[model samples]
Target chain A: MTIEDLIEEFDDLGDWADQCEVLIDMGRDLSNMSDNLKTEDTKVHGCQSNVWMVAEVKSEPLRIELTADSDAMLVRGLLSVVLMVYSNRSPQEILETDVRDIFSRLGLDRHLSPARKNGLSGMVTRVRAIAAEAVGLQS
Target chain B: MTTDMSQRPPFDVEAVRGDFPILNRPLESGRHRKGKPPAFLDSGASAQKPQCVIDREREVEEQFFANAYRGVYYFGARVDEELEATRSGIAKFIGAESTDEIIFTSGTTMSLNLVARAWGGKFLEPGDEVLITEMEHHANIVPWQMACAERGATLRWLPLTEDRRLDMSRLDEFLTPKTKMLAVTSMSNVLGTINAISELARRAHDVGSLICVDAAQSVPHRMTDASGQHNEVEPVDFLAFSGHKLYGPTGVGVLYGRRDLLCEMNPFLGGGHMISQVYRDHSTWADPPAKFEAGTLPIVQAIALGAAVEYVSGLGLDRIHAHESQLLGYAHEQLATISGLTIYGPDLEHKGAICSFTIDGAAAEDLANLLDIRGVFVRHGHHCAMPLHEVLGVQASVRASFGVYNSCSDIDRLVDGLQFALERLIVAEK
Candidate 1:
């Protein structure tokens, strides 16, 4: 499915259980991170989970990939949910997508802790920075 | 929500609990089972407001709400009176010398940002150090980092010991001459560790550094005098806390600064109600509190906050603390019996009512979700301090906190929910 199609499908879940199941499926579907890309440069600073995200700009569209490891299974599941909307989009598209609005539509923000919210923001920041770099702006 | 007086002495628990309508109501999401009532275990994120505070807010909005300090009509005067009364009430509650020392902002985050921008932004230079512990909420941490980055200052962290308390043994080493400010939390929202503020203040003072306390977690649960005048403890230079956490309306908070220091610092935001005289060339600013209170204040919310302070004070903080302590002790004992559940914070004697714990082999989010299915609400994740979570060697933890309306039975519900969730998870794995 196209990223947009997948997001729509994920958003169709009626309750949190279905949402979580879809999130796990998304995690299983995520493209693996290359070993060379696993470095401090790709690390998200403020997340409790060890989330590593890397972005690269090719000719037509930018590509974003994320891999998160946590002792906690649901955090890994949450990272999968974050990646579904965020990965494999142009930098500008990533910035303009209104991730928070998407989260609000799913009623996910209420269930999240303040730290997870910050982590979500941090992920957005990381993606935006990569996007800014692709467009030749200092982040 | 009514407490039985026959079981114990008739404290004002009933009257106090009655004020908070949310305590009696079911959760917004309903109960776990079809017939069972919802049990709320999360008061740490934000608290449910009392009906009195809410009604007061609505009353002000309907009758007396107006732009404070700048209005010329009768409504404006009434609003100004109500707004000023909030400052006075806050000042008195915190034992400040005068209302001029109190500044209203959107909430604790903005209040702390004011200190970081106005005080740290102006005074701190490159190479100056800002000392903060690992346990601060992001609201306290990010603002200082922003200020430090702007001024080319360096940020220093005070480490936490094995027990999750601040490692005070090396406190002197951290408070060096380069330190211009020390910002710390009075009570950690995640770990529930109440630091020795007086000792911290004294240490900061000895190094000629100003100390700012984030009392967002402490002010609601205990008797806190941030004003620095009435107590023998060396006064904190600035204090910030939110109204919503203290059973008041949201969108309003207090920032207490020493009068002279407030007078010396520039205002953080500017639009209206902050200037004495305006002109094209130059406009003179008003005095301290007015200078900081720019734009239209949250007048009705402020009035409700005043009422909230009155409500909490009437319950008597000493009695409230005693009641919560009893619940905390009971919770600690029960939680200790659960295998693979590791609690982080000071010992029960030193901690407040907040408890953070991680269960083995189960994600905090999943555990929280399971607890929700059992009609128990809890906060799961890093609790806004990612650095502290990293220090604690856990990805995230489930936090169950208490408020004035909470009782021992509430803790029992939480424990039951947690045990049930753990068993269900184990069964599902099997």
Candidate 2:
């Protein structure tokens, strides 16, 4: 689903509890990332949780597909939300996306802010780097 | 949540709780949870300030504000007198011989850094070793590591046993002739393992090694005798603890050193107040504390900390310990009932009032966040002790630590929060 759809779903939720429930459900719904893919190269540093993320560049469309996992259920749920915004999009598109605004609207800012230096922000940093690298290679 | 309070003296917890205004005020998250009072179990991180301490700080700042020891003005004299009185009170609190041994620093981290840099730099030689524990807070470990590396000294570890207590059996092997210093925590910030400081001090003295204690966790909870007058232990050469952890303001801590040791050591930070005679060629240093306290100290905070010492002294650490020990037993019993929860330290007998644990599928941060929703504050992650976390065989764990103000109701809320978190996150794991 698109980031807009996710935002709408979150907005429809009544309170923090509903939003948390939906987030956890989304985390549960995330496709299982292979254990083998969770290597040192895929690890995201500066996170309190153990998070792993890998980005693949689609040659035809120059789009980045992101896959990630976390030992934390909430982080996995956050990964779902982050992935929804960044994955399956062109490198340029991902670069232009305002992920912070989206997170603020969802009221997940307090739960996962950049100040935390946690999984969500670390994933975003990794994603942006991969996208920028892809752009650098293309040029 | 009914604790065994039969053996202890009458502890008026409600009266104690009334002194801390923050405890009565509902947390910001309480809006969602029907204005629930905060079950602040993160005192192991930093205790909440009492109104008296807060008032003391305001009284200092508003009434007689001046740089300590700088002027002969009335305000300056009042400030210096107050600072000296605070220092004397602290020395008395820890049973230090003289007020000069107590050097005020920013916090426990600063206190540890000061001792490691100043004392270790002056004494440690090549081929010497500094023995520390694997379960120490990073504040205790990293400073020593840096000091050792800089001074060409070897750093060694005293590993923890399976139950998370220090393996004292290996003490002889670790404490050799070359062991110049034995730096250890009085209590583990994460595991709550209360190390035998007196025993360790005796053993270190036997090997002719000076012992420095990171008492950030211990000093607030129990009695500490640096001079070892009443306590069975030998005099601790160096001891450090933070004021904030003792329910005072932040940015103020005490570093108690042996008089001779403080006099012999060079200053960690060289600046204005530390110098006695200043020439362009070279400068001589001041007496013990002034030699160490090189800048404008956290004047108001230190005075407030004096008030904190007074408050804790009035309540008596004995009663606090009794109340907390019983509460800790209750917490252990309650937390154990939850399926898949594994507490990481020894039984109540071997530890303090802190509880660190992990559930089967719920991650530490997730559990902590969920607890916050219920107005229960806890600490998550490695708690600045990564090596201990590695030893515990987990990436991270949730910690619910208690203070004098905490009650059985806090534990109930913590249990309630954990159950809710388990129901929500564990199911999500599937």
Candidate 3:
């Protein structure tokens, strides 16, 4: 979705300040990993919160799904922001997009804890690795 | 008609408070209602600068700004002298054996990285372990992990006890002969637990390992001397702390290594001022302090940091310690009475000036935001010690830390803001 669409979706939910909460809540709803799925294999490294991401590369384009279990709800929200930007994109698109630049545009860097920033970096790295594997398969 | 000033204790809290210019300015939001005041409680991250330190920095820049160690001009000579004097002052303040052992760097992170790269990276071998505690900030943990990774060494961690103190009882388990280095923080930034560095250093030495103490948290509020005096604790092999935390300017910090160890290690960064003799094929390096300091150092900031050390030292660290402990005790007692608040670290008696607590049913960021609206500034996060937070079973906590200038009134304002925030959260839930 475009930035405008995302902004509109956020604004429609509540006040501008509450939009973050709404986004976080959306993240919470999207993140519903079962206990059985919360294995070491699915765990995302370097996150202060326990995040598990499982993405499948469909035939036409990449489709990814992620679930995070964190005592802190905001971290779950942050993970959701990551998913919205990365999931459902092709490997080429995923690698080309500037994730750090997007985070800068959204002012996510200032609002996030250093650990969360590192977590975001870890998430980006994992997604890039997955994308690279997919591209290698096609080549 | 004069007030009975003599009746008060010899240490003047209000006088000490006046030195910090940030306290007088309007809060960052620049607005206040009647009978409301802004209280700052984020000293655990970095402290507000005193006017003396600020003025010293400006004076250096405006008058004597020049590159150090290689200039023969008037400004260069003066700047070099000021830089060396600051080195001596820092070395004296931390109780180091000599100024030669002290190296200035960007901050604590760089200082720790220098050690990890130079000493830890060079000496440590495959199958050797570097021991650190769960309470380490990222600056302490990441460097060792990186060094170990590069050197094919193992990294081991000592767990934090339930009370958040370092589990020293199991120290022997981690201090194997294969352990080349033990790095730990003197105080926990998130939980405020004070680790016994001397004890840990003794244990490491017993097993033929050296200890590096991250004194970033302790140096600010307590007396920390690298030179072991009659009553002072024994010095660790290497100690690192930031200038900003101790009322000095940012972008300057100190790394105090034992002279012998510093001579043994290779240089971390290579550039001008660090080399002794150079050719197209080979080069020789300078002695300890100059060898580690690669380029033209942060000369102005270093001089200002010396002024800061003098300013704080004049007031006496013992007095500062007592003052902070008093405020911390009162803050702990008051915060404990608040319902649904769970504090990390040992009770006020066993900790330093930091207090990290979580309000039941409210996110730490949300609580911090609410408090911010009320002009009560606090830090809300994992505090760069995420592993410690994980061990404590908390994702984030609201930290209210005290410095030399903090008073009981500041604590009162924090309590008032917290109570209001809790009320609002509870009402919204209903």
Best by DockQ: 2
Per-residue lDDT tens digits for candidate 3, residues B80-157, read: 899889999888788888999899999999999999999976798999999999999999999999999999999999
Candidate 1 has an fnat equal to: 0.27
iRMSD, model 1, in Å:
4.3
TM-score of model 2 (CA atoms): 0.96
Native contacts present in each candidate (fraction) = 0.27, 0.57, 0.07
lDDT of candidate 2 over B344-394, digit per residue (tens) = 899889999899999987889889878877788898999999888887888
Tell me each candidate's TM-score: 0.79, 0.96, 0.79
Residue pairs that clash (backbone atoms under 3 angstroms), model 2? none
Q: Any idea what lDDT model 2 has?
A: 0.89
| Candidate 3 C-alpha lDDT tens digits along A1-139 | 5655764665464332355555455544665667887788877777655667776677754444444554455566666667777777888888888577766666556556586778678778888888889889888
Which regions of candidate 2 deviate over 4 angstroms?
A: A117-119, A133-139, B1-9, B29-31, B428-430
The parts of candidate 1 lying over 4 Å away from their true place are A1-139, B1-15, B28-31, B35-37
Which candidate do you rate higher for DockQ, 1 or 2?
A: 2
User: Cα lDDT of all candidates, in order?
Assistant: 0.80, 0.89, 0.81
DockQ of 2: 0.58
